[model samples]
Target: MNTVEWSDALLLDYEPMDTVHREFVDLLAAAQNASDAALPQTWAAVVAHTVRHFGHEDEWMQRTGFASADNHIMQHRVVLNLLREGLAMAQAGQMDPVREMAGELAAWFAKHTQTLDAALALHMRREPPPVATVHRPRGGRGAHASPG
Candidate 1:
């Protein structure tokens, strides 16, 4: 079974964020199920996706003036750092850490999505559109980008 399963419960009703989150769950599952030889590449894919995923959310938070922007971004940074460390360990043939990290990420994602991400989604829905177009970087690795 996938470490994180997608369902209605995870929907934030924000298409852009929901799409990226679904991709994150899928990537996590891929990493979890990867063959030993494929684990590093799969994990690297997840890291790349997360970099863009978090970057996209951070941009949205900044644009929308999310009340907890700093705290949210900091959480992203910390998690990304740990994921990178797991990737490095996987590169060194230490797959156990990567597997464990994937499991932990599943739990973290559930709570973070329902709490932090849901709040951001609600905030975005209530914010007025920006006067100018927000310039988002091209989407990360396997995902497509949408305007924030």
Candidate 2:
């Protein structure tokens, strides 16, 4: 049970996106509740899920001509970078920072979902894109498959 719960306020009314978001919340909570011995691994899981989660959203934004694609993707990059940094610190036997980052992410996610993601959901509803064109990119870590 992390600070960020999967409440209706977080739902975007878009099935695929909402499903991914719910998974993100679950993974995050798993990390937050893991024991000291499990923290690093749990945190890593969170990072991995987030990488994919953000990638999905980023792809959707790109496909839907989201007006704030640049800003939104930049935020994703920064957050992913920070999460990776936390993972590194955790691997080096420094868990406090990762814990703190989890809390910060809880706060940040609440706002991000409510605002940026909400707007994207609204746009998508108005102008739905073909599902086939939204694959994740390839190459490198968290790479998305090419858009079809």
- Clash list (residue pairs), candidate 2: 136-144, 136-145, 137-143, 137-144, 137-145, 138-144
Please give, for residues 44-114, the per-residue lDDT of candidate 2 as tens digits. Answer: 99999999999988998887778999999999999999999999988888888888889899989999999
Instruction: State each model's CA lDDT, in order.
Output: 0.91, 0.87
Span of 10 residues, lowest total lDDT, candidate 2: 133-142
Give one digit per residue, the lDDT tens place, for model 1 in 83-139: 999999989999987898899999999999999999999998888766976565565
Top lDDT model = 1
Please identify model 2 stretches exceeding 4 Å from their true place. 131-148
lDDT of 2: 0.87
TM-score of 1: 0.85
TM-score of each: 0.85, 0.85
